[model samples]
Target: TLNKKLIEKSEELKQLSNDLSSANENLIIKDRQKDDFLDSVAHELRTPITAIRSAGEILADDDDIPLDIKREFLNNIITESDRLSEIINDILYLDKLQHGEIALNIHENNIIETYKKALSPILHLIQQKNIHISEVDLLNQYIFEYDEARMIQLFHNILGNALKFTDEQGTIQTKLSEKNDFLIIKVFNTGKNIPEEDLEMIFDKFYQSKNQNIIKPIGSGLGLAISKRLVEAHSGNIKAENSGLGVTFTITLPKKIINNNEVEQ
Candidate 1:
């Protein structure tokens, strides 16, 4: 009997050792992730700050600079400052979303109205590029219950990407439909198609495609990652695919939440 009790204790100790090992491994992974996130934040912040500082230095040190050049330097300072502000806001918003500190204002909202609101922010860029837009909606009266502001953010990020990558005078096509108890939104832009391997990583934080050739705003590379989180928070799905000439972003949301009490419901 003593020998049997000793064997049982030995097994329990071995199991405990294995569990401890797994816990240590998890802790290491989390630590590495934290480091990566902080590094990205630092890099994003430093870029704009450095630009702003350089621009400000030029304006302050060069009294003989031409008026046009001075104006350009001032514009650069303003633009870089705004970029810095946006990155900080995005970081704060993402933290709140991840920590469940922000409450969603879910209500019945018109899909078209939401899309328009999201596009408003980027309309100037669209016009400057002369990008053509087309839309198709099969749902007669498209309405869904969602957080209006968050949904606008979700669309804004995706639409911004579409406008960013599409060539001058290129076309952006959007489609909305309802099927199988889900509301689907698809955005396709004509320009460069994303590499096959990068499709899966497109929504990852700090992930950016190396092939894009567009000149646009400097970004923190958190837009798509945040959009993915927002979609998941609403019990929805977001994905991208190569559409013959370019790439298409597709979002799917449930038509109705069963209980509508859970965060993802």
Candidate 2:
């Protein structure tokens, strides 16, 4: 009996030691990720800041520059300044999300309406691109519980990404359907397929795929990260898959995401 107890204790200690080692490894990984994020943020901000400063310096130091060329530099300054502001806003927003600083106002809403509402922000560009969006008829009667504002934002990121990579007159489609207890929303865009390795990292902060054959927009690259956080907040999952001739983002959400207080009601 004494030997058995001693062996048991020894096994427990070994397990504890393994757990500690695993945890230390995780901490090291987290530390490395923090350093990498800081570096990425600095580089993301510096590009725009440098352009703006250079344009400003040239405009300030030159009195005899051509009016047209001067106007071009001024436009460059404005564009870069806008890009800088976007990066900051996206970073702050992502931080709030990661820190659980944003609360979800979950409620019963029409999934169809929410998806359509998301397009309002980028409808002009979509129309200009002539991207065809199908499957609206399928979302007709599916009602689900979610945070409407956040859901709209989630859809916006997925759709905006689709638009960004899609060429003019390229196609975009949304396939909405029900399976078991979850509602799936898949946004498909016809364009260059994301590299296999990049498909997984597309949701990482400041990570953009190298293959952008159609368009090169000054994007903050935090949209998908924010979208992922928002989906997780609602107890859902979002994934990117290369399907057909383009890439598709599929989001699956449960039928209910009731708040604690609402649960009482």
Candidate 1 lDDT by residue in tens digits, 83-152: 8888888888777767766667788989889898998879899989999988887346788888888889
What TM-score would you give candidate 2 relative to the actual structure? 0.90
Task: Give the residue spans of candidate 1 off by over 4 A.
Answer: 1-16, 210-217, 258-265
lDDT score for candidate 1 against the true structure:
0.84
Candidate 1 residue pairs in clash (backbone atoms < 3 Å): none
Q: Which predicted model would earn the best lDDT?
A: 2
Each model's C-alpha lDDT? Answer: 0.84, 0.85
RMSD of 2: 3.2
Worst 10 residues of 2 by lDDT: 256-265
lDDT of 2 by residue, 93-164 (tens): 889888777878878899888888998889998999888876645636888888899889898988998988
Give the poorly placed runs of model 2, Cα more than 4 Å off: 136-139, 210-217, 258-265
**TM-score against truth, every candidate:** 0.88, 0.90
Error of 1 at 74 (Å): 0.7
